[model samples]
Target: MSKTGKSKHRFPEFTDADAWEQRRLGEVAEFAKGRGYSKKDICSEGTPIILYGRLYTNYETVINDVDTYTELQENSVLSSGDEVIVPSSGESAEDISRAAFVQNSGVILGGDLNIIKPNETIQSTFLAITLSNGSQQKELSKRAQGKSVVHLHNSDLKVVNLSFPTLPEQERIGAFFQTLDATIASHQRKHSQRRV
Candidate 1:
């Protein structure tokens, strides 16, 4: 394991920085099971939608581009732009616990999503990255059932350990990854266009 409990790379400047604080997901964030949307509830054009399954398929560690929208009979499922949507169920245990940071406001938080809204001290992107990273995901995945339609409950997420550094360090990590994600997205767009 690397310093700060990371299993991989660390910022050069923060190599000697303080060790990251370790805490359970429940201790740092509020979690809620998202509202389930029926097949009838989903639409091609309407309020932007984020189906929990999309966290694994469409997004990387963070989601800025919302491609699908649906009309909800009730509009209670909306993001304030900081919710981290996690898959509550998947085809395999390894597929569970995948997450995406939602920064776009007004997007609907669909069902089968374990939505994590981190408290004021935690950066949403950093939390998203930490969860996206292999370590935390491994811990969470272990709790997921591997049988058909594997599921991870809100209770399961509440106990997953998350390691994080100081506020400033978290900011740096989040900013760095955000920029990296943007660069990757830009390149992907170009690559797709080239093939067209």
Candidate 2:
């Protein structure tokens, strides 16, 4: 479990693949903070919006659709469908470490969210998964400041090291997890219906 490029486990197909390369999260992505708007600005109808709290409460690794709406504010940040978002502040350090990929573009990104837009070298879903689990999550928790109200800034995220394989491999890995999440969601729906 020493910090290394090679993971203890990987997909069987990637067995012959090269060891993953380590890069700073900022090196492979551009960071931006979601602008304008807050819970008070939310509306019953308008532009779809994602507030920071939803990252931990309602979203998993990927957010393809949003349920919340808000009035479009000037200079508001919008998702490009390839951004990974993390809460800027949370009740605890562990809560602030959660990350989710925005898979639909044009959704308004509300305040208190740190958005990471990955370049061609990485997949958004894979990057979110990496940040939400393993070494990166622990690093983020350690970097988060404040006791009563934990905060994680983009500066703190920029320095964390992330290991990534080739783009094709990343896509395969992300797709696998995406499928798994879908299956789990479907089963949960079925279970909910059974209880009704």
Candidate 3:
């Protein structure tokens, strides 16, 4: 039995000892803080910019035609496999430390985010999924600190622990989820076409 109320699909790689490995997040990745860009810099074209607070509801990024920037302004370039995290956010304690992954190229993170590039051993999707999970979010919540506005510093993120399976297993897990996501997107497109 599983928590989802379905029969447990045993994953051979997920043993008790493998789950107990203590690995620091910094050891597995590099965290880069996003540079600040003024509101005036935004344009209707150029590059995609990801704002931190906007990721709360949407797991996948929503592109706005009106939102963009110049190549010169985009100091930090995000590739498909990189993970973006919201290190600082509004006064609400809940939104702080929320994270998302960059699924496409030509994307730049907004001021409040800290972009993380996972090493070759760890999959970006795995880290993104783990951060989004409730259990990890709770752990992050405890680490977040501030008076008026909550913030997750680099040190806080560096110490966060993550468990990983073999690289092959990670790739398999990511691929399975990618297929499911593509199917969902296809269904949504078809549904939208019918509505029109």
Candidate 4:
């Protein structure tokens, strides 16, 4: 807060905007778990699918494209394009704290993934970033449970405390991160191509 009650830290455009508000993850979002599918189910070409492992390996802030495919099953969990997904299980608690914003609908979200669907109060990309790399990541890491194989559940995520600006600010922040990730990916592709 500043002398005028606006936020002390903000983008130049939002200098006059109000301060951010605090809310629990459960207050602003609903949770679901991905279902079905596994590594053996992957096929050369079929319906696009995002397995839990992809959240740890292939994705960052946003998952706009998918290269893996599988034959669609009856009870597949599909992305609504507004979901923030985290791997439900991993070798370590810290490793399972990552998340990605699902940018396409109808893509199957495979089992062992926790899905967060934010309400109109927050942007999906922003929420994904919050859980994946922001201050809340450490909190989430602490909530994860296991010994040999750590697991994160919807209940664990519900109590997370998060702070957010207005929806417009969230959209701007989300777009900024999305563009940043795209640029990094582009450079990585070029570097790999040169190496080959």
Give me the candidate number with maximum lDDT.
2
Residue 153 of model 3 has an lDDT of 73
Best by TM-score: 2
Scored by CA lDDT, what does every candidate get? 0.81, 0.88, 0.64, 0.88
Q: How does candidate 3 fare on TM-score?
A: 0.71
Model 1 Cα lDDT, one tens digit per residue, 25-125: 89889988788675567767888888877777678777888888777556457888998878888898778867788988888888888899999878898
TM-score of 2: 0.93
How displaced is residue 143 in candidate 2, in Å?
0.7
Lowest lDDT 10-residue stretch of candidate 1 = 1-10
Find the 10 residues in a row with the least total lDDT in model 4.
1-10
For model 2, residues 1-196, the per-residue Cα lDDT tens digits are: 1234557777877764466888898888899999878789888899999999888767779998798998887898988789999999999999999899999999999889998999998899899888988999999999999989999999999999888888878999899989988999899889999999
Model 2 misplaced stretches (Cα beyond 4 Å): 1-5
Model 1 regions more than 4 Å off: 1-8, 15-17
Report how far off residue 106 is in candidate 1 (Å).
Answer: 2.0
